[model samples]
Target: MNFEKIVQERYATKTFDGKSIPQSEVEKLLEIIRYASSSFNIQPWIIKIIPDKETKDKLSPASFDQPQIKSCSHLLVFCANKNVSENIDKLEKLMIANGSDPEKAREYTNMMRDFEKGMTDEKKLAWAQRQTYIALGNAINGAKSLGFDSCPMEGFDSDAYAKILNLSSNIVPTVLCPIGYGTDKPKPKLRFPKEEVFM
Candidate 1:
């Protein structure tokens, strides 16, 4: 499908059919999300994919008992990684490995490190969380492009998710995305006109 159609047709699926999406399709969707743009290309995000019913059941309550949490094929916990310096280091190595000039790679990564040092812990989390939304956008649209359905959610309790997922202190849960086949039909698409939305 074209991009226009994908955006127009995709909806926040309230319920799913409880059928499993093929692992290959899931991997392709992950690739789309992985390539989401981020500030400085630091890519400060870690996605935890939950495919088991047992874990989804545990997460449902934290998600305010949302049916999407349990009925979707896979629950994606998009976490903001606060370890900016660590990712910069890894990116530097990857660049050099991919035939980038070693000096240029070091220069670029050092610049990113300097930028990272300017942020406080709270700022780091906030910035990283914003970046996760970009990935979340790709996830929702990408699911539709892949012939599936998705719901991007922010209603879950982040602290509860961090504890339940056994995530590290540096990994902060920022959003939830559930992917599956929608059992519910779409309501009318509502939006303000471009005149009201854009200057």
Candidate 2:
């Protein structure tokens, strides 16, 4: 589908049929997310895929008893990786493996490390969270492109999710994307006038 059509056709799915998206399609959607851009190419995020109904049942209460939690085929918990330095090191290695000069890779990674060191702990979490949203954007749009539905949700309890998922201190759950075949149809697209939205 064209980009315009994808954007217009996609909606925040409110409810989903209890059907699983094919594994191949799910992998394609993940590729789209993996390519999402981030500052410094640090890629400071980890996604936990929950396809088990039992876990979904456990998490729904934390999400205000939202129906989407249990009805969706899969839930993607996008977590911001607080360990920015580790990602920087991994990126440097990837660069060298992909034919970048070793010295240049080191130089780029050093720059990223310096930038990360300058941020406070709070700043690190905030920055990572912001980057994670970019991935979430890709996820919703990509779902539509691949003939499925998705809901980008922030209504859940983050702390509760972290505890339920047993995430480390460095992994902070930032957003949720529940993907499935929607039982509900999309309403008409509503938006402000183009003139008002664009400067």
TM-score of 1: 0.98
What TM-score fits each model?
Answer: 0.98, 0.98
TM-score of candidate 2 on Cα atoms, chains taken together:
0.98
Off by over 4 Å in 2: none
Displacement of residue 147 (Cα, Å) in model 2 is 0.4
Residue 77 deviation, candidate 2, in Å? 0.5
Global CA lDDT computed for model 1: 0.96
Summarize candidate 2's per-residue lDDT along 1-199 as a digit string, tens digits: 9989999999999999989999999999999999999998899999999999999999999999999999999999999999999899899999999999999999989999899999999999999999999999999999999999999999999999999999999999999999999989899988999999999
Q: Give the root-mean-square deviation of each candidate in angstroms.
A: 0.7, 0.8
- Cα-lDDT of candidate 2: 0.96
Candidate 2: give the clashing pairs: none
lDDT of each: 0.96, 0.96
